[model samples]
Target chain A: MPVQLAIALTHLLSRKRQTLVSLTGIVLGVAFFLAVSSLMRGSEGDFIKRLIDNSPHITVSDEYRQAQRQPASERWPTGAVELRRVKPLTEVRGIRGHPRALAYIESLPGLRAAPVLVGSVVLTFAGRIEGVTLNGIVPDKMKQVSTIEDKMIEGSLEQLAANPNGIVIGAGLARKFGLAMGSVVNAASPGGEVRTLKVVGIFRTGNANYDDMQTFALLKRAQGLLDRPNRINRIVIQLSDPYAAREVASIIERGIGYKAVSWLEASEDLMSVLLVRNLIMYSVVSAILVVAAFGIYNTVSTIVMEKIHDIAILKSMGFHARDIRLIFLTEGVILGLIGSLFGLTLGLGLMALLARVELKPPGATELVFLPIYWGYEQYLLAAGFAMASAIGAAWLPARKAGRVQPVVILRGMG
Target chain B: MNPAGREGSPPMLTAERLGRVLPGEVPVTLVQDISLTIDRGEFVAIMGPSGSGKSSLLYLLGLLDTPTAGRILLDGRDTSGYGEDELATTRLRQLGFVFQFHFLLAEFSALDNVLLPMRRLGALDEGSAQRRAGALLAQLGLDGQAHKRPHQLSGGQRQRVAIARALANDPPIILADEPTGNLDSHAAANVRQILRDLTRELGKTVIAVTHDLTFASAADRQIGIVDGRIDPHWRA
Candidate 1:
């Protein structure tokens, strides 16, 4: 071993109590840092997974991001053209030239798209009226784009293919209306069209509001009741990689002149809020490491103070200033290395403990374990910050030890 | 104005108008315009009263402190322009120091203390360094006390361990500041004889500061200092 490292080891070994105290501080700091960060990031990942799973990756709605330019504005670019008393044209609320658009969308690889006609309606059962959203879908196409088939408690979406006037309603609404599968309820559209549809399917999505206020039916039957034929107002899309939604949505919007919004774009505010929460979490945890570094500084400074005589003798024996500095700095590095090793092990144990904790959330039928995200970056970050703090704390006292002049100390010794 | 170490066989150490000043509010001059010479294998003693700057002159010659106004030379090379690292290197290879007290590291054994300089100089392997440290301790009559810490040894044994440490790197010149100042009469006499033997038998130049008349009388020559200046008429 180098003489400096040997000196450092002797110094630490001679003062075992103070050295262990400093090491304990670092270990606890790193362990707590990793534990809290892993838990927080784990929950965030779980929430994002649920968000991506339930919602369509992209929704191409029958609307433009901007209104169509006037004929005069289109003809003369950048010209100050103003027309007075111009009224906007009214059109049917459905995507125009939708067949060509659907064919174009289906050409893309690793994507599934389905047409949906959604509108508001009122349901009356035994003179009890409740407003709800009505979604019209083709059974086979809807199966590729949605997970409603898996959520069904009674019958599947394919049953609606056989029954022309079938409707699927949530368990919440069925309970409120005192109805069961095969029961008939009167649904009235805004255009004065009414029909008695048979409830062919019942589903429970575990969200009370969605379970109570949403129903699904066949596209042709819905068109006949609502008086809009051969029109689809939206295309719900699922992708193999949901994170690629933004790029796909933008491409579709540019191609078809509709508003195509990705789940990422729809939940942009929630993403930013999550980012700010992570920043706050890291700052709080890093503060613990900084505090632990102070303990190292105190221990090293005391060692320097106690060894002033030894330092003087070594300097008189022709040890360079930098060699003395290296000895102390080596002490800090040893502490950081050993501390981080134990802390990482403790943090992993904590994560394992957390992963086994089971809880039943309200309205959930089964127990769910706490999510523990096993990301490698958190380990790297924790160790990196600890070493930085340890080295930074050691620098000041090492410099002080190096600047000790042997002559003055020798004079005082006499 | 004559520089030390310029005579026959080229004195192991030399000083040229050596001076040291404590720069502070009062600006004290510790040593002033001192020029001296001692040939190889000569044992010289510097005698002075309290606060007479004898230790200051010794530190200047040992390269432990930089002279404010003059230069020193070891083995005929001027050291005025050398940086701190070079000066330290020269001190490690050419000069050894013994302080008034036995400055052995308290945590180290007597053997380890003797090995400290050899380890720092890295001139030999660990096994060789250990053997050399054991030999130095045995020669100093500390044969069985090599593994004892400083606190376990007597005052005289500790001083002998310090002398063994100083000689570990085998430097040619040994500079001691009151080598026996902290010991009793018996220990003092033993330390004095050991230093005298270093110059006479081993051909090592020895310069020591002392208030003991017997220690000064044993030297080849004795110089006296008063108020930071050499007293020309004083002799022993």
Candidate 2:
């Protein structure tokens, strides 16, 4: 062993109680840092996964993001006359030539697109009336882009294909109307069109608002009832790799002349909230390590004070100031290394224990386990922070030890 | 002329009007305008009353403390311009020290204590350094006590361990400050004889500060100090 390190070990071993106290502080600090960060990251991952799974990766709607330019403005180039509140030209509200658009969108690799004609309708059953959104879908194309099939409780989406007048209602809606499979209800559109449709399927999506207000029917039937034949206002798209939604959405918008909204763009506010939450969490956890560093500072400072005479002797024996400093610094680093090793093991155990804990949230149908992220980056981050804090704490006392003058100490001894 | 002294060769150590002052509200002078030279392989002693700057002058000569003025030359090399690291390196490779107290590190065993300077110098490998430390302890009649801590050893044994440590790097000059001041007569006599033998057998230049007249008499020459200056008429 090097003389400096050996000396450092001896110094630490000489003060067993203080050394152990400081070491315990570091160990607990690192352990809590890992455990808390893993839980936070895990829950964040879970929340994002649910969000991506439940919504379309990209939704290409039949609307322009910006107002269309007037013919006068286009012809004048830089017209001195600025137009304000100019009335927009009125047209039928739907994607023109949607079949051509759908074909173009489907030509892209790794994605599936489906057209949806959504309209609000009032359903009357016996003496009760409830307003809900009716989505027209082709079962074969919709299944590729929607998770509604997975949410089915009674009948299947394929059954809607077999019965042209069939409709799929949410469990909340079915319960409210006292309707079951094969029960008929009057669905009336604002265009003075009314149809009696039989419920062929029931779904529960775990969201009360969505379950109460959403229903699906065949494309041809919805078109006839709403009086908007051969028209689709929204093109819902799903990609194999959801993270590529932003790029794909932009490409679709550029090609189809419609506003494309990716799930990431729609949830930007929530992502920022998550970022702020992460910042707060790191600051709180890093404060623990900083407090642990104070323990190291205290231990090393005490050792320097107690070993003043020994320092004088070593200095006179031809040990340099740097050598003396190195001894104390080595002590801090040794403590940090050992503490981090134990802390990682303890943190992993804590995560495992947390992962096994079950909780049933309010109104939840089943128990869910606490999420625990087992990423290697968090381990590296915890240990690196620990080492940095230890080194910073040791530096001041090490410098003081190095500046000890043999003459002053020896004079005092005499 | 002292028989063991090399009369014609250049002096091993030279002090040119060395001065040291403690700067404060009231400046105190520990050593001032002191000039001296000791020949190679000479056993010299500086005898004086308490607080006469004997230890201060020794510290300056050993390169443990820098002088406020003047210069020190070891083997014809002037050390006035040397920095802290350079001085420490020079001390490690060239000079050794024994204080009034044993000053052995309490946590280290006697053998480890002796190995400190040799390890710092790094002139010898670990095996060689260990063997040399053991040999030095054995030569000083401390072979059996080499593994004992300072607190576990007797006063005399601890001083012997200090002496063994001073010779660990085989430096040419050894400086002692009241080496036997805390020892009983028998132990003092033992330490005195060992220091005298260093000049006679190993051709080492040994300078010691002492108040013991008998100890001073054993040296080839005695330099007396009164109030931080050389005093010819002083008698201890």
Please tell me which predicted candidate would have the highest DockQ against the true structure: 2
Output the number of the TM-score-best candidate. 2
Tell me the tens digit of each residue's lDDT in model 1 across A316-345: 898889988998888888888787888888
Q: Flag clash pairs in model 2.
A: none
lDDT (Cα, 0-100) at B163 in candidate 2? 94
Task: At residue A109, give the lDDT of candidate 1.
Answer: 87
lDDT of 2 by residue, B66-136 (tens): 99999999987999999999999988988989988989999999999999999888889999999999999
Q: Candidate 1 chain A: worst 10 consecutive residues by lDDT? A: A359-368
The segments of candidate 2 whose C-alpha lies over 4 angstroms from its true place after superposition are: A80-90, A123-129, A171-186, A361-365, B1-9
In candidate 2, how many Å is residue A308 off? 1.5
Quote the positional error of residue A323 for candidate 1 in Å. 0.9
